[model samples]
Target chain A: MTEYAGPLPTPTIDTAPFWEHCRKHELRMQKCLDCGHVRYPASVICPKCYSENSEWASMSGKGTIYSWVVFHQAYGAFFAGIVPYAVAIVELAEGPRMLTNIIACPLDEIDIGMPVEVAFEDITAEFALPKFRPLGKP
Target chain B: MGSLGDKYAIVGVGHTKLGKVPGVSSIGFNVLAIKAALEDAGLTREDVDGVLVKYPTSGFSSLFSGKLCQALGITNKLMAVIDLAGATIGTMVQYAAMAIDAGLATTVVCSYGDNPLTGPPGTYGRVNSDDAAFGFVGAPAGYAMAARRHMKEYGTTSEQLGAIAVAFRKHASMNRNAQMQKPITLEDHQRSRWVVEPFHLLDCCLVSDGGAAVVVTSAERAKTLNKKPVYVMGWGQAHPAWDIAQRESLTVTGAKRSGEMAFKMAGVSPKDIDLAEIYDCFTYTALVTLEDYGFCKKGEGGSFVQNGRIELGGELPCNTAGGLLSESGMPGMLLLVEAVRQLRGECGPRQVNNAEIAIASSQGGILTTHATLILRR
Candidate 1:
């Protein structure tokens, strides 16, 4: 495929590991050493206990749909032709919410508290976005 | 007996033509707004010791306020650009009063200017953020998600959200100066094209080119001003400072704590507020704020907004100048300006009768920050 025209994440020193995990199709979050609070998007310090000591813990990639919206308006060039995309805030079982698209499902069928699991969509050879799909659906 | 309550007052308010201005750059509107507000206050730039501006949202530069002051050929003892998004306007008044109390400056000008409507095509549509990578890059999407959550949690219907649009549009219809003069019905809101699901075109605010400013001075000094000074009885701010996905509840907002602090400072409660100029960036934003501000219980804003409860002449009239829904979408500064006007009884047809007390709310960055202000006639 040519270069992916949609938006892409620029990994920082902190978030590089998280993005790398995504490329490898592994879900991991930073859990504080002191407080055991898990966080997303890769942070240096624990927001709960201010602990700089933390480790990347593998996640189960399962969650519930806290909420969702189907955006009809294209906000950028990449979305100009293909809008009406549904975006959801999926609250992972690990207790952190992720902003992602719900795929492999009908838009009208999406609902709050619906069980879901991570499904990776590889945009480029080395990059993948972790979307979600209805639980137990092949 | 709050130390800051009733110590300062807004002496003047000014704004540019709403919706469409052909050639005015962002800073050009700031210059125009400050001059008009100064003239309205019967004062000149020389009398102003403080200048706090919320710069154009479309773009930003370090020392933007410095550039604005240089354009106006004025020097001030206190100057900075506040960047709380829509909440900056109400928070500016609080900061101005603090500066005055601390003897840093006596009289202050708080203003905002933007040209998103007329400046460059797709200016309002373009949203650059980390979330863009995942296919969400617009304001409406975030609010629509929150609105969707509110619906699922509280049985809030699309019609309930329509009440907000219908009410503010009705108020705007009565306001000749509003950008949208025609009143819309619930059916119109339902029929409007979807910007995002759970949000029609009516659910979103106008993209406007505008500049708005207000002059605040010591209450004692306001006694000498030309207009009937609207006293700044109370001011408070709250910023949860978390991303929407990280929030504890989508329906609850920073306005909850912000309003509590302001009402506590003003020695009043939500029921004491005769008129409220809430920042209605969208209909759901205002509805939830009405709940968070304690006007009604949590999860009850849907019913509370129905039955003519939030329109003009209703109990606890809100956004009588049409608000961002129908008025110019100048962020929230215009809401503060309108609140002052209503308190002064200057709103020709849409004024809240016997409006002795009013509360103006400003929420910034998709309900991430909030500021509440209580004023007295």
Candidate 2:
């Protein structure tokens, strides 16, 4: 019930729908109509095909941990209490990467290539951050 | 030799007293560095026609380099700011040569200065909106992830990273002006506290208040100057241009292509060089960049740096002035400055023996951008 004191992404004209979809607990990426390259941090054109035509496509939000780090030190004030937290680069099943947090897991339990699925954290009334958790087993 | 190779040369190099220079401002550092460099080149402020600056880390302005010109009380035919983060220094030199080559300017001074040590609070921990929401705020988090991945992929131990810290600190002990003069061992590296997982305090570069500058001119003009000219043998730049998440492989960096471009232009290979002034933003960076430059095989950096091979008398003396690890962490400017000094035999204690050619590398944005400058005396 407390307000989110940490930083949040300010939606741009192009990135608006991505966040809008997140608020609805639906993870969507901008997919190129020409080459079908799904991209994050939504852009006007697809990096692979350079096509202006695109769609807000749905994602399974299931991914394997490509890489991760445990932050022993927090640089900002709000994060001071969380001395040790894990931020991971998730390789989505749909073929795009997301910079996100892996929640519902201990630090020692995380590893590269670990299967995970998306779980939403409603940090604020207006925004819901998409996090990940261990899928079933190690 | 590559086109435009050996065509330009660095005539002078100078730096402000590094390590906790508390009272001077960033701009003050730049001006002092320029004055010292000009004196080294036996030239006056009037001799400078172009000025390229890597804008101060602590401030921003529309005409930042122009502001530097105004501070020096001179008009420049060409002036601009370069912003490639740690790669700014090498980029500045390249831009200066191109400007001079096109007849836009004759003599150019490239410089960078920062006062983060004495700057206002929150300088080191400014809020980055992109990753801050995920309980990450500092610069180390991004690199920590990279270091961890390297560890997983190559079986690179924390001890392997410790070797890099040890070598650089040993070199620092010989450098009188280096920030961290006390030599530390691999055990000492292990004893240091962790700022981020997979990264010890010693694994990071020293933060300091300092400035460094170099004077660049045509090779012909450089020969006429007061001191020996460090010929600009070759230069090249490359950028991944993607965030860490989007990159195909986090373990690799652009240093591979950039180093090749420079070596081709300089008509040399990695083994042809005698010294390497690599940017050590993190211990991981030093290891990975050397690997990317073909100094050693991929995943072999940890072992390649194990012995005294990178030391002063070793196969390839690297970071002879301690680099960003023990030297002032002013991005990559000081690396090139040290390369210039080593080629000129200006370094008394830490100088490499009979140094002929050197490669100065600059890295920016979490291993995303890279620039390489090859120099020879």
* Candidate maximizing lDDT: 1
Scoring model 2 with DockQ, what do you get? 0.72
User: How accurate locally, in lDDT, is each candidate?
Assistant: 0.89, 0.87
Tens-place lDDT digits, model 1, residues B1-377? 24789889999899888888879988989989989898989999889888999968887679998988888777746899987888888899999999999899999999999888777654356555558888887688888889999998899989999999999999999887789989899999999999989999999999889899999999999999989999988778999778888888889999998988898889998888999999999999999999998999899999999999998879989999899999988888888888998988999888888889999999878688899999998
Positional deviation of residue A137's Cα in model 1 after best superposition, in angstroms: 0.9
- Residue-wise C-alpha lDDT for candidate 2, range B228-328, written one tens digit per residue: 99999988899886888888777889898899899988989998899999989899999999999999999899899888888889999899889999978
Clashing pairs in 1: none
Alpha-carbon deviation at B59 in model 1, angstroms: 0.4
After TM-score superposition, what is the CA distance of residue A14 in candidate 1 from its true location, in Å? Answer: 1.5
Residues A1-138 of candidate 1 have per-residue lDDT tens digits of 878888787778998898899999998999998889999868889887888999999999999999999988887678986687889999999999999999988889999999999999899876788899999999
lDDT of 2: 0.87
Residue B131 accuracy (lDDT) in model 1? 85
iRMSD for each candidate structure, in the order shown: 1.3, 1.4
Q: Classify candidate 2 by CAPRI docking class.
A: medium
